[model samples]
Target: MNLFKYWKKDVPASLVVFFVALPLCLGIALASGAPLFSGVIAGIIGGVVVGLISKSNIGVSGPAAGLTAIVLTAITDLGGYEIFLVSVVMAGILQIIMGLLKAGVIGYYFPSSVIKGMLCAIGIIILLKQIPLVLGLSGEMESDRITFINFHEKISIGVIIVSVVSLLVLLLWDEVLAKRSNLFKLVPGPLIAVAIGIIIYLTMGQSGDLALNQSQLVNVPIPEDFNSFISNFTFPNFSALNNPAVYLTALTIAVVASLETLLSVEATDKLDPMKRQTPTSFELIAQGIGNTLSGLIGGLPLTQVIVRSSANVMSGGLSKLSTVLHGLLLLLSVIIIPKLLNLIPLAVLASVLLIIGYKLANPKRFVEMYKLGKEQFIPFIVTVVAIVIFDLLVGIIAGLIVGVIVLLLKSYTNSHSMLIKEFEGKKNLYHMNLAEEVTFVNRGSIVKELDALPQGAFLELDFRKTKILDYDILEYLDEFKVKAKNNNIQIKIISERGIVDDPHSFREFFGHKVFKMGH
Candidate 1:
């Protein structure tokens, strides 16, 4: 049997993600000060290079939203696109070193709530930035320069009206159309909205009498020859290596990009239908290799982008082949029809992204997070607020710090000053007054106490009225059994369940017939 028989199942999803990837590649390149073709190059590399090496089942890597701010700053500070490429190359080397040092474990340290917060915040930011584009108000600057200042131009009332109407249409499609009409589900609503927007733009562009602002039109460079296409590629200046500022920029990019990649990988794994988790170490290695190649080829650094990954999963991607094919399409599209690609209207692409952004940062997300309990909710809200105020990395660090502090406080509150009390010269006569529910977070203190027991000692774990034992804590108890055996100590577990030497397998060790509770 073929190990990857599932590859065939991913065709539909791959096609959808490919369309999603296309506009994002171009738009992000526009957002960065890089050439438009360079964004396409990064997408091609991310899909072909990272996708091939990644252990993740559903994630799709490419030019990341997280790096837009960095790219904007680098392009200006370095005074040229070629100079920024050098920083990217150095960042890639740093990622490789981080992977070799086994820093992949860093991903596991982030609380799930905080990760969710980061995703939702990014969604909001993407939508906010796309507003001006949707209104055909992007022409304030030369087609080459993309900056927030471009929004200073007055947006025509007509464009605003059309954008609002388009947004409403999208909302209706997502809610009523998708559920009530069988055809709508099979054909993605975003694609249809894009087609409609393009039709509208074409109709309006033709009216010679209409006052059209320069910013409303999409500007795609038409490459005439093979030489022009090749010339589009940029190379880095390694001479920038000696600059302390370059090193700082490189470190910032490496750390933020790595964190974002890890977070995306974790989220994508959860969306896998088979619930298979990606290996963090393997993921880091793939990212390192992808970033190194991307930088070398005059492309942007990449991460496992959630937008692409979500599209992949929703479209029915079942294997990495889909991602690889998507990359191939990206590379082929720019090379074969650079002129044809320019026909796409910026407004149409804006509509598609607006829908995606809404899904990610929906108010329902907050409601869901709040329902997960205070432990999950507080950190989730904190992360969202911090990210909105600061950027991605600083917000995540702040969230993590708060999470740790919360964890420590919980530990202190639950920890009994006297975990165990003993009866002198009495065998199997020890007492432990634990809080109502025992968790593995308390395992450290409990294990330390257990380790100090004298040889030939009989242990008693008192849990006469304890309501529950967390699975993690129960696993720790299982390990303690082996430790007790090595020290010639007998453990007596006293619970409502009854007295037994082994709590985990007590019923089996004594008699399965005697225990009637859930396993």
Candidate 2:
């Protein structure tokens, strides 16, 4: 499908994507506690490698912000960055297996509320993690629990000045400038913000009062030659392959990355002017291969990220060439200008991430979910709270549990439709129409309704709508017939075959067929 027929469009699009990807690549890496260079490696591999294999012409892959929390937690729990790489490799292997087994359909089963909660939780974590960096305080001050910020910790006036200016430019560019001019649209807000940050760094970062801490800036191995550049790559510790934690983290990364990729793919395809469909099963395989290769070279886990892909489309990307080209640009930047890239202040990246977090957990989302009603809103809120309070996997599980319970409650309450009326001289008559598909889940409602019928009252069971009858319901009806006889209550069976002359023969009627909706 990718014949590179649109290089004119793809070229400019790739450059736009390169600009959008660079800071996010660095920010996510800092949040994940991995060596800063690894993010660049992942970004390069995501674009160059995944772009080649994915069925999506417009979907761009890269280091994801969503994975920052998981990556951070896993890196700490797994002992070191080298050991965490093993999980990334294992996750790629699992994703490959998932693709081979056609497990793409599994993503559809996850409730949207749960997915939203997970993203929102990650956003909150990102926002919290960046506060220290943005404030000019050491990241270690809030490295573990961001809530424990040191009130007395020294702050950098220079960092604050740069962050505020960067944030204002980003806001103005997004809300006022971009809509007004195509030039502004082509030039992304983040790129402008980061550039401003670099300008501040070069102009004032070396001064005595405005002096910046070395720890508060981007740090990449400034390779002097080809060999030195190659030497900068970090490899996974193979010995950690035997750890159970490695397997669990691997599964988590695989599931989350696959889900994110699928969601991004869906969004990109919808935004496609051509309305082209992406082959999801094959896309997962592409992600798997990208991740495996990335981990081998000490890169962060990769996903088909929505941010970069959106940038690609907005920049008029028409082919996978744009995606591949963007990756080459990232590769070339690190190799050709490592020293220049290192001058970027961590605070500037912090401002970019801060906006990302706000977008994810915007208060409007809560109101939106509430308007959806309790059935949806409960699971959505539960998932968000759980993820924020605990971890990603546990939160999703919690949401699913709540979702299932709500489903069952609905089934129990709505098994049958009914109306109560009196005929000539009849004191009480119950007419109930069962649902189209009656299963064991409706048994309790059926039994309770049957027992609650007034003595000597006329009760009618209408099976005309019911097509699939569970044996449990059928058995309950059979036993209820015996009780109806003793209680002197009249029982009527209304099947598609028409009204039964005798209730005793109702069970026997099933011997021929459950219902005779038609001849």
**Best by TM-score, which number?**
2
Report clash pairs, candidate 1.
139-215
* TM-score quality measure for candidate 2: 0.82
Q: Write the per-residue lDDT of candidate 2 for residues 224-308, one digit (tens) a residue.
A: 8889888768999999978999999999999999988886776577657788978888899999999999999999999998667
Task: Give TM-scores for every candidate, taking all chains together and pairing residue i with residue i.
Answer: 0.72, 0.82
lDDT of 1 by residue, 71-173 (tens): 8898898778777887888888888888888888878877888888877776676567576766656532211112355566666554554466567776787
Local distance difference test scores for all models: 0.72, 0.80
Model 2 lDDT, residue 324, Cα: 97
State how far residue 302 of model 2 sits from its true place (Å): 3.5
Off by over 4 Å in 1: 1-12, 72-80, 135-153, 157-187, 206-214, 238-249, 314-316, 417-519
| Error in Å for residue 104 of model 1 | 1.4
